[model samples]
Target: MLLPVRHSSCVLSIQFRAHSRFATTRTITTLASSAFAEIISRSSSKHQIYQSISSDPFVNLSIEQYLLQKTPEDSNVLFLYVNRPCVVVGRNQNPWLETNLKALQKHDTDIPRSGSSVRNVLYVRRHSGGGSVFHDEGNLNYSVICPRDVFTRDRHAEMVARALQKIGAVNAMVNERHDIVLAQQPKEFAKQKDATGIEDPFEESTPQALKVSGSAFKLTRNRALHHGTCLLDSPNINNLGAFLRSPARPYIHAKGVSSVRSPVGNVSAGLVSSAEPFSMQRTILSIMDEFSRLYGSGHEVRDCASRLNMTKSEFNAGDDWVAGAVGEVQLHEIPEIQNTFEMMKSTDFKFLQTPEFTFSTFTTEEDPRLRPPLPSFLPPLTRISIRAKKGIILEASISTSNDEAIAQKQALHSSEILADRTLHEIDAQAWRQIIDSIVGIDYDGQQQQQQPMEEVVDHLTEFLCEKFGV
Candidate 1:
């Protein structure tokens, strides 16, 4: 048994011996058992273990420590989303063959910067009622992570992909978090996917045409479903879990057998051909954009799924409405932040976009009650902006009360209210009062005001009525 690393907590895991011709599934099972055994034996938290694994200079010690120290709260559940920039040879795939690492090195640096990349995995509070995801951020990177025991690995990735599917992805499959693939799928898959896009209804098909830009993933869409393309069989759960829970170096080697085809296979070319699909992120944006068009950009969230062709029951609601899935969180820009809590603090113009209303359902075919994981690492609740230029960043959050997770899933396949306000487009008067309150130094952001607060609301209402006119 491998001993626990210093400063790190025990993480249970499963691995797929992806790069072998004769490698039986049993071997991977053995590996998974060992990984889980190591985790269970540790009797410590994953946070403790992660600290042992990471030593980044940019992160805060306490927060970093908090991230590494796994609590006794939940079992180590490896919820993996393969969004890696270069191919990540599964604990078994040969890196050289699977990834053109040297080529990706340049774009790898170009990948967008986010706080969670410090360790390159999403983390979730144990049994925290949800999981976390490592996002691709539009780059071709694999999203991989481990969480406390709330769901299985097979189910975890499927849950993520399925949620992604809700957004209309025709080829999104949870090939293990560590399981990496070419930047693009095989040729046949590309041809089929492309042809379907051109022929299908404008709203029903994915907008992207398939091209081999090194590599990318396939998302399964509803059309693909109608044509009968499925994930076939679940991969070795133990192997998948371990891969998500552990970093590659110490656990998996770079070299492997030439035949290391992934059992955590992607959607086949055949599948992509039949299932013309919209990407989860893309679908959410389309709906949002349309909502914006109907109500004006950044209006309140309502009847999004109804706008689509699917029925309401198909929405696949998890435990709660996953606001984080929307990727819509926002933050205020720097100059706008007053240095001295002054009566009037202003410097520039700006806006913030919250998350998409729906993505994937994080539960497995078995445990749909379990919610999809949260974003790999929760960002500083919202983004900060300047007057249309560069600026410092800040955080903001949505109360659970304001976001009904289950209701959203139900609404996906049918018609229901997702949110009362999109929180993107508020009335100019509301903006004025918020600015005034901040300027007048009377109220704090998001907090209710006393007598003047009512006045603030009235002006905001009137301003929206007069200005935004929604």
Candidate 2:
């Protein structure tokens, strides 16, 4: 109803006011974002907890290495996981020297030679330096990564022991060597736990003390990784013996690190004093809670419940697979991390990392699988000298005499398999004839190939038996 100019002026005024309000709102938002950025910059050293859901030992271990490598020097990370059955050896330790390869081969078959459905055991070598340790679903492994200056092995181990006690392992104590042991628990502890709805897994009558955990450490340029295994309620501990056997040969003189063997026990058998109750899920949560309380900042500690991610989507983008709650924990698996694991397990890669050493092959009599032991009257045979580099046998030679002969010397010198037939003479005539006959013996024109070194040895053993009339 007013003049055109007057109405236009009023409309312009309203528009200016609206724009001013919008500007003010944007300013406030900018200020809040700046403050949040400042807080993040100040606490860049915040501690983090990663709970992996993958049960594949290879995948879990690869993810651990990735996290340790990716974490900032100032930040601290705690990784927790349960791996399927596997044997993890130390970085510097020799696989053949530390474990029984033959026994391990038997464990690798999906179905045992006896046709049992027991799971195959996987072998892994960690970047840390320590003795070999067996891992299964019952074993809980924790790795703590932090700056070198902030790292305290004893304090970290004590932290684990205290958390263990909180979850009903009342008598859990860390030994000097950093192993957690259950000294002894009173029999009445079980009744108190049961009355209070707490779980005591081990039999009350079996009060024998056991080893609960073993730890190892690796210090890099600016950071340190402290990883250890905590035994939970593993059903099959008996299979541990099948893979962790004594050395194949006596007197292994190498500069490599050796494992100090000890009597190990499981945490399930440990003593629990609290009526608060116990469970694997509770134990895992408690350990993380204690870690956050001890190391995390005030807000960080309080927000742990929300920050803890148990889904694949939470950990990695584009990962939709969900590893549902096993027991009480909802686990997550990221397939992208598997590339690293596959690389780590590759034959050429792992084998090339082995240190150089002189090795002696096991004789027929020393073989555990053989029945009706070979007669001692047979010549001092089956003793072979091998010089290997990175686990690959570079030089091999047969030793007829009981005394140790160098591989180079034996290969150069003529050796006698029998009383009169020298190796040099046999190679010129008998060996050539055997090779020709073997080449001619093709299976349906599949083409006969050169026999493998191990099989060649077997053929030689049989040839000797025939020549000596054994």
Candidate 3:
């Protein structure tokens, strides 16, 4: 369950840029112009790295896409960011089937002040092909964009695994699925045994590997983008299931990919030593170092560092790299980034992009699984079925257990009201009003039955709201 919490709604305006073993501070406008120019310029550095200061999911993702498209074709780029709490589904996945929209709504609220905007949780559809993922401040997102020829599914995943190992997580390894997982040592292997009889704890026979990172990819004719989420020290790990599990899943038969559930564990949980507290910053730095080792030129390294203030030694002890500037507010000034950001936040992109699916109150030919029983508050034989494409209702029908002709007519009217409407466009209040009008209609002047119908309508409205997240 997600609880309502207040968050800031301001956008960050400051920026910083770093060079080899030195730091230079610049204004937002200057940094955005230079950084934007450098990012898209083909003559720019071959190995580029960036760390996003903003926690906004929309802003961070928009920046990522911009880098994927605008960066030099042959350049190998690494972008690292942490987003505020959000559920991000794949490009073709259905949010209503992958996420608990009703629970997400509990965290939605408006905050008027401004400096850096914040929201408790958001629902996003990313431009990648994979299952849904949950992100928050505690999770670090790493993206590597390179030429298509050099791209391999396990390349960056292995890099991240090495970084995790460097930070004392020896159990971290890339699995055959190209995901980073922590191998669980069996109870028998936990104790010292005869050298001859000891079995490899991480052998293929072990069945309980806990996933710590999940990978997703997007490829173009020239560029390949690989990105993944690393669960470091998330406090909401236990609550992830509540957000990702959808009540509407059993009711919806969707066309796109569905998420594969895995037993997930935090990387911080399996650290070898507790002398130092786990930190996302440390994990990010380790990953950055690993990326640099793989792609950086021997002479020096450059990075678009966040706004955090740090000494030269804090960033790089040797004369290898320096931090620079780029802020979310400045990135928005770029036309391409602004357009992508707005599009990502729009309802059209969020819901209208969903693949075709059907929602039924009872099992149908297309969706043959037995459905959970409906609430007992309504008629036992009541049925509702809906078919949608690109989120628009193409067909709908509603019926009650009643055999009365008047009741049948009301059901038809209700169905007609729903047709052609987009699922996201209809709110709970709108559904209530539509249901009220049809149920309020005089049924052969039987005014005495209207009261009971009203009660039924109220229950039906609540049920629909929960099911559809209207």
Candidate 4:
């Protein structure tokens, strides 16, 4: 549906030189001498700006995809928005290996419960390849969508670094890996510059620098998108740490992008000025202006920067701009796009679509305190390995190498303990079914009634006992 026009008089057609070989004339409806005009310039190559009204992570991601697919070949696009608190995994990443499932379980427990319904932690996977990152209101996310001809990851990163610098981060710089880092100490800055010849203070070796932004990209035959998270005032860094920590399952092996752990700082920490601390709206406006300055044509910069200011509420409601000529803002309502969004939200698609990889579960060396005390009959330590494919157990083995005699004795003990190896397969299949069902439900537990953790654990134990004929 076309947006309702508020003021007919506000509509104006802006014309400029078209650069594309296929088109000689192009016109955009935008406010004269406004940011919208600059964004939709008649120039051969131009950019468009769209801000999502909803904060639903699923909806936001879907909107992103819609914009990318619908973008005009001659025009680039920019999206600025935040998502509800959730953990987004990269497309190729293994959910079991990249995230702390145990922590997620506890996280689910921490959510406030009402009646039989329980709020649950959300897990979203994106088409881009990057280590998992946490998202919330405090994290501002932006996406640069453009054709392959004009898409440059390094230039976009530099633009983001400049924008951060404009918002009170005087020392912000883009590192070799394209992360935005803040260098507080002179030594740290010097060490980083000398090492990589880049201004980044958060080089891999620089321990003092704190990363404020991390970027990733997705490319298509004709288009490309670079999106990233900017930490401004994350409410719970501890939750970020806990959820992003390596999984306790060490026996699993997969080829995936691993997150580079680094000290992170909130952009709000450096967002202060002589007059007052900068607000999120102000920060957003500053970034929009910078984006216009970098990507907009010379004929549009001054007018665009001067008029780029818009409050969060104004952007969300969009009564003024969408209907008028201030900008070309399109809210996606395509049924196909909506269906894709719903499919992506499903557990079957998210977990089962992953590349083939080995997953195992057993007591691993996680915390020293959690290690079981040494048994007198067995060696001081025993290592067990269980291999599985798509949740089906393939092999099981327990080993000890304290000494030859100890190894032989341990093998004998393992035979007794692992007498019913087939039981492991049956138990694994049952547990997989349970997890598959749980994840299929809505995160808030509204769509399905979830079994209590104690009940689930007891059920698994009972299944195992029956399998062993105990």
lDDT values, one for every candidate: 0.24, 0.53, 0.71, 0.55
- State the displacement of the C-alpha of residue 49, model 1, in Å, after optimal TM-score superposition: 21
The residue-by-residue lDDT of candidate 2 on 1-470, one tens digit each, is 11122111011211113644463221101011112112212334355555665787666677677656666677766778898777788878766556655444334434333234345676678778887888877788988887899887776778788889888887778776777766664564443332221112333222444566778998888888999998876554444545565433342333477666555555665545666544677778777767766675333332332334454312210011111111111112333345667777775444456665544444333332322323354333434444556655455445433223333333433222222332212332465344333322221134343444345444555543232112
Candidate 3 lDDT over residue span 60-166, tens digit each: 88988988888778887778878888999999998888988876745653322212223556889899989899897778999999989999999999999999988
lDDT of 2 at 107: 44
Residues forming the 10-long window of minimal summed lDDT in candidate 4:
316-325
Over the stretch 1-470, how does candidate 1's per-residue lDDT look in tens digits?
Answer: 23332221111222335667554331101111123223322443221111111121111111222222322333221111112221222222222222322222223222222212212322111111111111222222112123323323343334334433444344554343312121234564455442221111222122232211111121121100000112221122112222222211121111222222222222223243234443433433432333224222122112222222221111111111100110001001111112211211111211111111221223334324543233322211211111100111122111111124422332331221112333324435444544333223323345453445455445433422321122
Error at 449, model 2, angstroms: 28
The alpha-carbon lDDT assigned to residue 200 of candidate 2 equals 21
- Candidate 3 residue spans exceeding 4 A from truth: 1-33, 105-119, 187-206, 273-275, 302-325, 404-411, 438-451
RMSD of each: 26.0, 14.2, 10.0, 11.7
**TM-score for each of the candidates:** 0.23, 0.63, 0.81, 0.65
Q: Give the TM-score of candidate 3.
A: 0.81
Cα deviation of 175, candidate 2, in Å:
1.6
Assess the local accuracy of residue 262 in candidate 4 as a C-alpha lDDT between 0 and 100.
Answer: 69
Q: What local lDDT score does residue 200 receive in model 4, on the 0 to 100 scale? A: 20
lDDT for predicted candidate 2 compared with the true structure? 0.53
Best by TM-score: 3
